[model samples]
Target: MAHQVSASTLRRVLNIWPPFLFAGIRVRALSADYHHARVELRQHWYNRNFVGTHFGGSLFAMTDPFWMIMTMQALGSGYIVWDKAADIEFVKPGRGAVAAEFQLDDDVLALIRDATADGGKYLHWFATDVIDGEGDVVARIRKQVYVRRKPPRDGNG
Candidate 1:
């Protein structure tokens, strides 16, 4: 990584990011190793839809950056990671505070590395379930992440 920042610092920065801040999205916890993260969205007038429930965009936004960021951190600078696509299904009306947790397991990381070892790209799908305060699922989000091992650099600079 070009610049190394603590996981807690990253969490603070993400919490104040404009898209997240205005959407009432908060990063509740980010592990030191970036293997796990929790994010929440609180019901607010600005983030409510016409039906008086959580805005679909806000719900999706809360889970947006976690997978790609966490995967990148876990893989370090030797690999490239990108969010290729995403799909979100609204399962229920979101009220109060809804949260989503992201976890990267060792097996998944190993799979990514093995798949990308040949200098080819690997696409992995990560899932997140946004749940309400009562622990009911409010939405299901799927994110497709692309990873590839960075090619050896040619010294020219």
Candidate 2:
């Protein structure tokens, strides 16, 4: 495609999606320049686990798209991004409203760019913590991203 997708447009598409919205996921804040965002998970039955705590799946879902999305936006065009791997440690049950923030700092971006500049794939790691309304940690998530430089579009083998 010859067009570009802005962060605001992507955010809007996600917000109105039934799965995200119905699951009580809300995007509280976003910044294009910084490539940072904040999302909140409100307490609701749809997100309740069988034991009445927050659903583990819902907790994982709330975090799935943030890092990859932010990294792609931060890195700009001519790069390939994908979620390589992820692991979550559930420290405590999420009982109420929970939130998580995603960030892409200059240092991190520099590292990614430098590593992938040679057209080699690079793995970038990021961490996020889901916090309750009282600011206590509910879960810690670790994500690994695969970044690679796109080859020139010459169509020559």
Candidate 3:
């Protein structure tokens, strides 16, 4: 079976969630095929720190989920996807709206397929910079995903 979920659907669904809505995450742009997506976090009291800057948890939250979801959609159902690991480096305090763009290009997809073609587990790392409205890097996030082809369902090992 092919992927029934579209980017628009994902965007719409995300827009209504508490994490995305109350936390001020906006799905700004999403490709039709789910290969790319852009999300922004607008600075608000709800997501601000005690010092009145953007909250670290909210900043991290805004950057989360895209990579894993994108990879699953791009690679389709034959592969198992998981967020193996992640790290974030905060470069600056986010004062205003911050945005992060997640992209999965053809080359990256090809690399993932090549690496996992033998049904062996493969790890793929993707990085994105969280930037403030002026385009200054507020944070950098690295996400490593584990992908492997699922074994046949007939109890074959």
Best by lDDT: 1
Superposition TM-score, candidate 1 onto the true structure: 0.96
Taken over the whole model, the C-alpha lDDT of each candidate is 0.93, 0.85, 0.88
How displaced is residue 35 in candidate 1, in Å?
0.5
Better of 2 and 3 by lDDT: 3
CA shift at 85, candidate 2, in angstroms?
0.4
Across 70-133, the per-residue lDDT of candidate 2 in tens digits comes to: 8887777788889999999998999989999987789998999899889999998899999998
**Which clashing pairs does model 1 show?**
none
In angstroms, how far off is 45's CA in candidate 3?
Answer: 1.1
Candidate 1 structure quality by residue, lDDT tens digits, 1-157: 4355689999999989999999999999999988999998999999999999999999999999899999998988899899999999989999999999999999999999999999999999999999998889999999999999999888875
Q: What is the lDDT of candidate 1?
A: 0.93
In model 2, residue pairs whose N, Cα or C atoms come closer than 3 Å (at least 3 residues apart or on different chains), thus clashing, are none
Top model number, TM-score = 1
Ranking by lDDT: 1, 3, 2
Arranged by TM-score, best first: 1, 3, 2
Tens-place lDDT digits, model 3, residues 1-157: 3355888888899999888898889999889877889999888778888998889888888878898888898888898999999999999988988999988899999898998888899998899999998989999999999989877688664
Clashes of 1: 0
